[model samples]
Target: MNKFKKSKEIKKIKKIHFMLFFIAFIIFIFLSFQNEEDILKKLDENVTFESIHYTGTLEIIRNNNKIIKTFECWAKNDLFLIIFKNPEDNGVKYLKKDGNLYVYFPSADDVLTISKSMMKQGFMGSDISNEDITRNRKLLDDYSIVSFNKIIEKDNIFYELTLQAKTKDVPYFMQKLIINSDFVAIKTEQYDLAKRLVKTIIVDEIKKFGSRYYPVKVTIQDGIKTSYKTIFSITDVSFNIPIDPKIFTIQNLYNK
Candidate 1:
């Protein structure tokens, strides 16, 4: 009888240990999936927009000098309009509509329809490509996430992802992005067809209004001289604002 009681107690203890192990395994799996989803969701949220309006300055450094051009920009879906406010380039406007981009020059009194080849050119003499900002493509929709790796450095943890374009229409062929917990992209590297690093965009400042966080300041560096860096800073911004019907039309762009 004593032996039987000892055997029963040993079995009860073993069962409890098995149950605890199983629960731990389940918890680990749940946490792993939840983190993966969060990583993807934050990256996807950046490219999705309804309508946005921002007044900002575009500082283009060329010939060892920084040229500051102030402007107001409006974007809705894939359409965009940029109107310059600087004295020299004042009243100059760029409009993107129906998969085409057009620039209206007040001085020339002429509207030049930008071609596909021109998309690779600098936007308003800045390091930013016209294709980069005017393309209505979302990162998650146009690219496949190759790897989502969480890295720990010192006290902060950052999420990094390698993205490959799903279609040729996408802006960048390959991209590597590192973002922090606040869903702010700290660093982004753009690659070309040869997998060569083409451009690097670094976010310097981020501002939160209501429920959304926006990059208020960013610096862009291309495959150029160190003094050729371009800085973009926003003064004021609002999301999903009401827009006039004629604001996006080509006719409005000409008269604008």
Candidate 2:
């Protein structure tokens, strides 16, 4: 009788330990899924904007020479217009509407369409590409998260995501995005289908606009040619502002 009682007590204790372990395992799985979902939500909020108006300064460095250009840009949803404000490029307009990119030259009074093949080419001889300027699609729109991990450095926390392109229309086949606690991507690495790194973009400085944080200073570098780089600075910016829809139309591009 004494032996039987001891055996029963040991079994009960073992069962309790197993139940505790199972509960902990379930909580861990739930938190894993929850963290991924929360991070995605934060990322979407960081990049989504109703309307954005900004003045940009591009400092393009090639070999040893530097060129400076300025432009005023307005974007609403999938439509955007970039008008060069510099003396040399004044009146040059780039418009993206209905998924097509068009360039308007005031001198010739002509509108030229940009082919998809040229999307990867440098924009205005800078490290940034035409697609980089006109792409308003969200990351999740064209990519699926293959894997992700949370990283803690000192007091800062970051989430690193490996994204695989879901559609062929995207510029990069694979991308690595490192986002900070604010859900802003601090660094992005673009890779080709061959798994070769093509480009890297880093947010050097960020600024707070109202209640939101935005990258005011960015550096883009060519992975193939390390000597080539571009520093893009947002001189002034306004987000979620009212913008005229007609401003994004091709007809408006030809105007003035």
Candidate 3:
């Protein structure tokens, strides 16, 4: 009887251990999924603005020369218009609409169409190219979220989102976006078709305006050039305000 009782007790202990392990495993899976979903929600909210109008300073550094120009930009969805305020091209206007880009020259009294090759030249001498601006689409739409990992540095914790492009026509083949706990993008690594790092954008500051989050100051650095970088800072940011649709038309580029 003593031997039988001891055997029964051993079996009961083994069953309890198995149940505890199973419960922990289930909870771990649930938490993992929940965390990823929460991160995606925050990212979507941060980038998708209803409308934005702001004045910004664009600083370009190349070799030993530094050029600074201030501009006002208005954007709604995929369309945007930027009017340079100073430094020789004061009246220059850049407009992007309906999958096309154009530049209006006030001095020449003409509007020039822009293409991919022209976009590669950069936007208003800044590191932000036409391709970069027009990629207004959501990150999840273009790339697949492959991994989610927590990074602990010092006393701060962050989540790193690794993305791989789903299509060949994407501007970046791979990107690693580092976001804070609040889901604000702190930095991104942009890669080319050959899997070469081409550009890195670091968000210096973010401002909250009436429940909307905007990156007020950002630095875009050229990966290959290393020394070349462009700092963009915005002021007087207004969001979700009414804007005339006609203003985005090509004819309106000269008319209004």
TM values, all candidates: 0.82, 0.86, 0.84
lDDT of 3 by residue, 1-256 (tens): 9999999999999999999999999999888866776787778887788788999899899978899999888889888888888868877888888888889998877899897777667887778877887667777778877888889999788989888899987878999889886678899998988889989999999987767677889999998999899999999988878888777877776763
Top-lDDT structure, candidate number: 2
RMSD per candidate (Å) reads 4.9, 3.4, 4.1
Question: What are the clash counts of all predictions, listed in order?
Answer: 0, 0, 0
RMSD in Å for model 2: 3.4
What would the per-residue lDDT of candidate 2 be over residues 46-144, giving only the tens digit for each residue?
767899999999999998999999999998988888999999999999888988899999999999999989988888889989988778777777888
Residue range 68-90, candidate 1, lDDT tens digits:
99999998877888899999899
lDDT of 3 at 255: 60
Q: Which of the two, 1 or 2, has more lDDT?
A: 2
lDDT of each: 0.83, 0.89, 0.85
Between prediction 2 and prediction 3, which has the larger TM-score? Answer: 2
Off by over 4 Å in 3: 1-34
